[model samples]
Target: MAEVHRVEEKTFEFEVPVVIVGAGAAGLVAALAAREAGADVLVIERDSVPRGSTALSAGLIPAPGTRFQKAAGIEDSPGLFARDILAKAHDEPDGDQVALVTREIGPAIEWLADNHGLAFSVIDDFTYPGHSARRMHGLPQRSGEELIDALRQAAEAAGIEILCDAHVTDLWADATGRVLGLGLVRPDGSTDEVGCGELILACNGYGGNKALVAEHVPSLSDALYFGHEGNQGDAILWGEALGAASRHLGGHQGHGSVAHPAGILISWATVTEGGFQVNLNGERFSNEAKGYSEQAAEVLRQPEGLAYTVFDERIAGIVRQFEDFRRAEAMGIILTADTPEALAERMNVPSGMLAETFAEVSRLKAEGARDGFGRDFSGVADLAAPYHAVRVTGALFHTQGGLVVDDAARVLTRDGAVLPNLYATGGAACGVSGKDASGYLSGNGLLTAVALGRLAGQAAGRRVAIPASA
Candidate 1:
């Protein structure tokens, strides 16, 4: 755990109006927001280059009522988006939080594109499991690497200063959790203390921490961590130390579609678009359509902790627009065959059993019935030759739990009291994904990151501006 300094009477090297920790989407967005609101902001990143969980993601964000949706003539609203989030999470999250993110996310992303020049386009072709509409927006490639790079470039262009390779190890504050300054340690063991009138924690969750993973999400304790290594629970731990409230520490985003051994993220589109998963026994284990996050545990429970995503050529054409899918195609990691038996042979699974699984799928589609696992295959088109498949395994993408925050993104105490001069955003704050991976709707992570991040920055900026005026 990072130490919390009592700061009875401390001196600082320098000061900034607003200080943002972590240079990922959340931090950069917060910096940009604060800067836009007429506040001087400083962003501190542990890594030399800014690539947190945002970089590892598909870079998609779910936002309704945006111009993109309007241009596409897709009728949508924040209420619909909020409803989808609750439906996916089984209404386990705070309804107000859901409403807050849903309401603000559209404007947040729109501000980014209009002001920061992010080339966002709505993904309307195929829908994610829980989303009710085609509201996902992303850059041209739809890659997180591009998203983060674009944000970094945007921040640089905005004249916001970013301190790289500076790992925050301590929070200097009073007992009230009113953060005053932070201690940063460089890779070369150098230290600096910088004071701030307001602080926003955008450092994200604890997915990279093995002990935390074991303590909370024990089922995925041994699962592959696909998020940024910098997600070490710094915000959660420090927030706890500062008497801030934390919730649903076990909640996380887990994906069952990571390409096995090759370390590539296979998009869930393959499964959502009439594809299915089969274990090494070449049998369908669970309904693959039950959301990819929950499918992680399902995949891990299978033999050898591995599963294969089986789809068709048409599905491949639909998914090729994604950068990761194209990379997998270029690497020739996706196996294809003219028939089920031939594909089973290529996948080294039992041909008879694989054929049986295919037959079952066909039966369900033909009968328009639900499977034993509750997956409905009636609406989707039937799979045809040539067949395509990719061997995959489950992995932890990021934890969806941390300190609780309010509408203004102010960090709160266990008693529901706000902590002054402090805010948490992104994975640093409790997410809307209920209490487990199953609750994760696609793009939930980025929704809060960009939405809550902007809100926090604006509130912090207003707070600072008010006092200066006074």
Candidate 2:
């Protein structure tokens, strides 16, 4: 931990209706929502450039029964979404949190699109793992950068001031535990205090902290971390100091197919469309249908933590619309060949074994058989001529747990009591996923981020008693 300057006795320099720490998706959304609900807002970010774990994501947000889904003629509901989460996160802590997210996701997304001018549409082409319907709503580019850019634009237009390079050092509170203001250290080592009636912590989790990872997620201690370096568990530490309760500290989101040298994410859509992963021995190890996060542990256990995603031209074409996949292809990370043998030769694997693997996949698809690894090839197509492969490895994207909060996004103590005037969202709050990498359903990160952010901002706005014009 680096030394952070905290002055216990100093006059606060500024005051706002709501002060948001960490200008990622959660902070930006909270600012927008708070301002919309008639509150003055300020967002302080650690990085000079505001790219957090949210910007590294695929920008997919799952919201069942949204107007976009209805326009696309897809039948879904929050009940179904909650059921899917419970099914995946069985026996995991904070199941109610999952239910709260499911219930509010639709409205949260709709509010952003309708009121904040955010552009989002239903991903009607294919469904992600654990989602019975195509409920993913994303920007046109399907990139988190685009989403963040849009949110920043909206925040700026709404008069939300985002101060970058403002690293928050501590929260100023009285003996009653009611947060009064925040302490910050500027990049030049200058310290300042900013007062606020309410505070929202959106700084995210501790994936970049090696000590926290080794303590909570020991299984992935050796895996590569691909999330933002700014997520240093400040929210968790601050919450702990405030006597806040925590939940699901072991849960995380993992990526199974990060391109080895290029470090680009290979979209899971390719795997769902027909692609498969094979180890260096030219042998399929686990079920590709298990989804990216769930398959990450399996990929980590592979020989030297290396695997190849083998697909055909058809699957590539189907998934090329994704910005990351297209970027990978443009970077020459995707290898192409006319035959399985040629592809295997290009991958430096035995041609006979690779051919045998493809033959087995085709035979199983033809006979409608279950694979030895419990993979079902029901909807996948047989690989045709002109194959494609990308060398990839597993990586830890972000932690999924932090300060436990109520449905209103107010921070809670171990005894289930709310901490006055303090709230948490995004990775700062406990996630809906279970206490493992496998419990992460697609888009759960952004779902909680945007939804709880909105809830927190609205609650703060109403509680602050600020004028509508402020």
Candidate 3:
């Protein structure tokens, strides 16, 4: 809500064939795609730097049947990936959106690697909660910072002009919702009007807006808002104001294991690879294998709205590839103990109860039994002495829903007609997550970000020039 205006009264200082807002993963990828299609692109970023929510993620994008997956000897297809999403969502989402993203994800990933010089490698070691295959692709560092840095480098190399610190306050359009230009408010109180042949809204969702979060995702109203400050729902608000249809506004992505106070994301790999969560009462709550998105609320619903992630040194070695975990280790947040009692002592929880919890977990895993909460302990390794634990709290990461669009990433009016020359991608568009945070499978954000971004850019690059009289 910084300002989303339909003010059509501006004089143009310059123009581009394609203008993209919010130069994150989505916007930058869109610029690249447009450039490839022979369009001159301008990526306008709100921040002085280009890092947005993409810098706050694990930089993982799930794609099926990619070269990375093939090299890992993992068999996966778009059908199986779609099935995993539908099965894990537990509620109905847009079937068309699911199918679109699944189909485009593989091609998008390969395109970035083959054309843009992004060194993507599949996470072949372990799978996330709801994913059956090792399809998570990331850069060498496996951090969102590296991801955004690479995308920015790629955009710069493509000669895409990314105007930084020029806050886009108004979107200019005619009565028909056909975009004419955008008004940018600069730092010195000066303004510049830039005409565009086509516009792409890649501004992220409304997680940082407390009023919107309280209004939509009330469950995370008091949770930690960990998204970028620029995610003020400008695209969503602007699209809605322009009579665009929106859906699932209450949906979002949340995390249960962000290191408390430290504020770095503890990769969910710690849980999916056999670690578990327990509250201050030294009791397991929901099945930890359940998706991390839902676990945010579960962790927040605990006694003190906090929980602990318990893992072994072996699991620590597995997750060390993440820059966040390595940072936590550097900060001494990953406490270690030689026994359950000792670990509980370090955590200041009841030693007796902690020992009992560990014993129960070991018994269940040894016997290949299922817990009451429906998490199967079968075939999973048990945590031994020299265990590692981190105090964590739940956090609201980002909103999942926004303006509704078709498979081609065109913004649709409430009447189901396409808005000419305007598109929404990334958090501006409705994501693959179905209804709420619980339905967010891992990598759904970046999957749709790159996939829809490329689609929108390609479509925008091919759009016809605006009529002279408008």
Best by TM-score: 1
Q: Model 2 over residues 1-470: C-alpha lDDT tens digits?
A: 43223344446777887999988999998888888888889999999877898788888899999999999999999989988887777747576777788889899898889888889999888779889999999999999888998998889989899999888887867655677788889889998889988999999999999999999998788998889988889899888777789988999998899999788988888788877999999999999888799777888899999899999988887777689998997888899999999999999988999999999999988888889889898767899989999999999999998899998999999898999888999999998888898888888889889999999998998878655577
RMSD of 1: 1.0
How much lDDT does each candidate structure score? 0.93, 0.88, 0.90
TM-score of 3: 0.97
Candidate 3 ranges with C-alpha deviation above 4 Å: 2-10, 464-470
- Tell me each candidate's TM-score: 0.99, 0.96, 0.97
Candidate 2: segments with Cα more than 4 A from true spot? 1-10, 91-93, 466-470
What overall lDDT, based on C-alpha atoms, would model 2 receive against the true structure?
A: 0.88
Which is superior by TM-score, 1 or 2?
1
C-alpha lDDT of candidate 3 relative to the true structure: 0.90
Deviation in angstroms for 454 in model 1?
0.4
Q: Tens digit of lDDT per residue, candidate 3, span 1-470? A: 35445654556878888999998899999889988888889999988999999999999999999989999899999989998888877646788888888999899999999999999999999989889888999999899999999999999999899999989988778888878898888888898889988899999898888889999999999999888988998998889878899988998999999999899999998887788999997788889888899899999999979999999999999999999899999999999999999999999889899889999999989999999999999999988778989999999999989999887799999999999878999999998787798889999899889999999988887663333464
202, model 1: CA deviation in Å?
Answer: 0.4
Across 106-189, the per-residue lDDT of candidate 1 in tens digits comes to 998889999999999999898888888999999999899999999999999999999999999998997667788999999989
Using lDDT as the yardstick, the better of models 1 and 2 is 1
